[model samples]
Target: MSVRCLLPLVIVAIVAVSGANFKRREFKIKIDGEVSFKATPPLSSGKTITWKFKDLQGGVIRVMDFDYDESATPQNPLFKNCASADKKTGELTLHNLTENHSGLYFFELNGKEQMEKFPLKVMRVVQKPEITNEKTTSNPDVVYLKCKYDKVVDKDAKISWSCSNDTTEELAYTKTGKTDLCCACTLKNDVSQETSDQICESDLFHEGSNIALTVVLILLFILLFVVIVLVLMYRFNNKFHDYVFKKYEKTTCLGGMLKNLDQCRSGKKTGVKQTDVTTVYTEVNKIEENNKEDDPLTDPQHDYEEPQSGDKQTDVENGTPLKKEDNTPTEHSDDL
Candidate 1:
């Protein structure tokens, strides 16, 4: 083989060996948390270690360099006091992490580049969740609750609910019952988790106040309806009575009306049977006069006394005599 051909074969062999030594790892940590990466095929004596970072945008930066017996010195300001290295294991540790530190970390052994990579993801700690409640209008006994976190720092974070009855992974939960069942909410992520304060069912519903208001309104409506009915009935009764009396007056005579009214007052029936009859009256009167001849005066039957012009008299009606003016003696004979 030519020299150039031999050189290409050597280069290919070297690349293949280096690829076998490469490693990749992944880690997730919250802000202010600690994480460490161990070097593969642990370092030997006189071997130097170098750690570098690659950002999400493909920007590379050197983090630190150290030997087995010497302490690590960081080159980036971001990892000034936050980076450390173990001399024995050639391990790299980082603390006080932030979102800006999320990137790929690489390390070199004996000043030779190695493809060993550690993908780190820095996330914010989960905050305490907040819970809010709403009563269902269609059913007061049912309450709807929502678990919320105001400032969500991680897109992969999840919300869950825990109650006396059961646990749920939904952010919104429906609770039912009048018991003192309590519930709490939790916000969780790959790095950390937090829980909210517990809330009870009694705090969401006021059954007593709602029931009292409904009862009072119903009573008021019933009372108003009763009053209106009574007023209408009173007016109708008075009008009916007047109408009946006017009808009665149109059909009967005044005397008959008085008779019927009296019978009604006495609690007797006013019905009367019809009859037909005829009546006549005749009058005959006898008068006595003094006899002008002396011969008639001798008889006892013809004896009479003369009436004076100034004397009071009596009047007769139906065979009964009544004095006119003052007490006086008068006689009459009549036939009718």
Candidate 2:
């Protein structure tokens, strides 16, 4: 063969060998599951790894190295949802994965040395579909029923509803990826006792919407009542005061004056009129004088004179006699 013909074979062989060197991986997980991708061996010095994701929509997303020393942070929508990677071995850990995470994952080493491709498929299962409404409708003979559950994005995940485990008839269901499903059906009022509220709870009892709403409404009402009471207390300060002087004394100090004042105001004091009493004066040393000159009743001038300073008394016969109105001889009465 010529050199040109041999050159084509060499290029074809090189392409085939390079394709064979790529590592392919398959990972199957449920929706909202977590997974980790670890490097088989530690990376060499001065060597870094990068991760890329290609979704079914033909969109590509790239993630930076695990070592923060290379870059403090990288801008990627999936990076916020994924876990950090190993600093030494460059292993990547993903967390809280959703159906949107299903895609082709690529791990490149040293920018070109080796490429590891991972084909990931996230399968979702029903997490106990909720029974929204299962009650009698306006028509007495007809009853209404409803149910809810998470959205299923894949075609393989089957969502359905049934009654009493009977396959004689199938219940109609609508599927969508945007929001959780809500389906309703009408039945006759005469339902079997086995397919009552108890069995419906077994179908979907993860929530009690009516009970939760009632409790929330009660709490809000109580909060509103408390707020109104506080506002009234603040506005009508004089009407509702902490200190009620009418019921009790606001202040009382220790003292007799205050005690008397309280007594006087309460009309507890006794009453009495003040009057002057008669006082009698007596002469201690003076004796009754029978002589006309010394007798206080006989002579008004003798009553006005004071007695001698010392304790001396004169006898009626020895003292000088005063002149009487008539010159009668002085009789020495034995009584004197």
Candidate 3:
């Protein structure tokens, strides 16, 4: 397993041996070495008290007894880990606790009722707080920070946050397992007053100082990627423009009427230049006017009305053509 993954097991083993190898500096070793208990009111002189130890795996055993009749028993040599008690005070002291001492211990006054219970748990000294930056912390105004430490015992440890602004904030820690507290906070954009730098620091422990660097690198990489894409798009923009213009210039597909008109003109005489189109239309109009003037039906002097069908039929039977008589209508014979 990786170092980070195996770290917890190693810390637990150290804590497993800490009760014997090293004692907590804050508490006296004598007091730390053993658990002491005494009955109230000096045990009332004549009354007695009994101390019992319940090893979770080994079963329950009576450690010692104090008698009001001046007969105070010594710690059972059988247990080897307990010491004698004061007969007058009815106090029981458990000494030189080892790994085997982890269990429950209780006291009984005069062997009648349970007076107090002691649950002994051995723990390793808490290491310095380990701090790490949260991964989702992308905001510049507020930075997310996390503090975690090994917890070997049930005792509560303090994790405090301090800044140069003369402010002390107690960080609330959440218990993850039997021996771990993971706490997080969103801090202001300003540098930590304690670290004397931009990063946060604690009196007991200081976390890795490179958290900010990693975040910066990630952001720079993302920005570089965006810039590259934009440059590529700009480089080929001319090709895209050419494609659109050429496709749109295909008049046959868009302006059908104009395309047909061009085809019709191309099929005509080659001598006729497209520039002479206006002149050709003017000449056609003059020819139409001359034809109209030559037309006999259009002559101003001709008083011509169309002949009746009957007249035209008779003329046809007689096989004689009708002549224009004076200022009247005319008929035509089939014989003519």
Candidate 4:
């Protein structure tokens, strides 16, 4: 053969040997001391191998079979030919092994046995340091931060808090327990008007952990304002009532004074010359006369009157007789 043709053959032979060596590599495994099982040797293509377990007394107790790869392993194959006790280990070899082959293998010796559970799990790497902020008041002086997590685990967890604008070193925290965790940080001294972008954060090992809180202070302020207004209104109403009563009393007093003045004016306008007044005066005079008549000693000549004489006397009284006619007075007395 020519040199070029011979070189190609040599390269192909080397590649075939390398592939076989890769397929025959032994699988790494760690077993629990309570369980004993035979480690089966790697098999070639289209071949099967059996894994058997023995008790402490060296008696065969259990057996399991596995088949090698019939086709080339795909890059993302769902199943692989490897068995381990921990989930972090690789996939279990199950070429011919169906659903029935999946279970714990146990061996009994002298009524005592060891059990080996197979097909470890493969956990996905999750994002860490799940951070969130609680709802807080805009008054930076009265606010605080609270951090929490959804679940607890054995791994070492860390928490970090920092102001958004300031690049200072962050505050760190650590905790380990079976219950949920929380922490409070006061921002009274640390916060200012310029620190409006303040924030709080947490670091956890698992995903979906979160924190939340709320502040409601405006309602209290509104309640206080309402109380003050009510108090002021009550005081104003009381003062107004007192003023109204005073005005009403003054009006009543003025009305009484006007009534008295009207009575005095009416008396002056009507003089005492009417018939009723005359009759009253006559009755008063009659009463006085009756009282005088009842007293005899008060009037001595009540019925006395003057006598007249005619001209028929003798010669001695001739002068008197002759003047008899003239003796009778012509005017009568005012008493009659």
Q: Number of the top candidate by TM-score?
A: 1
Between prediction 1 and prediction 2, the one with superior TM-score is 1
Tens-digit lDDT track of model 4 for 204-243: 3222242222123566678899977744443346564334
lDDT of candidate 3 over 1-336, digit per residue (tens): 799999999999977676443333112222136666555546766677777877769698878776776755555564554576777677666677565666676777766766345566643333455455533324332334444444443134444454222222333222222222223322222111112112422312223235667888999999999977744443346564334434543565643432333334434536444444334546988999888777877767656677685564336668777764566545754446
Expressed as tens digits, the lDDT of each residue in 129-239 for candidate 1 is: 778776667876566677766654545777667763434443334456544777888778888889989887666666656888999999999999997774444334656
Off by over 4 Å in 1: 1-24, 69-72, 164-175, 208-336
- The candidate that wins on lDDT is 1
- TM-score for each candidate, following the candidate numbering: 0.51, 0.34, 0.32, 0.19
Q: Model 2 Cα displacement at 55 (Å)?
A: 1.4
Those runs of model 2 whose alpha carbons end farther than 4 Å from true positions after fitting are 1-24, 66-72, 113-115, 129-155, 158-336
Candidate 2, which ten residues in sequence have the lowest lDDT sum? 275-284
Model 3 lowest lDDT segment of ten: 188-197
Per-residue lDDT of model 2, residues 126-171, tens digit only: 3444345443434332223443433442224333344333222233
lDDT of each: 0.70, 0.52, 0.52, 0.37
Q: Note the residue pairs that clash in candidate 2.
A: none
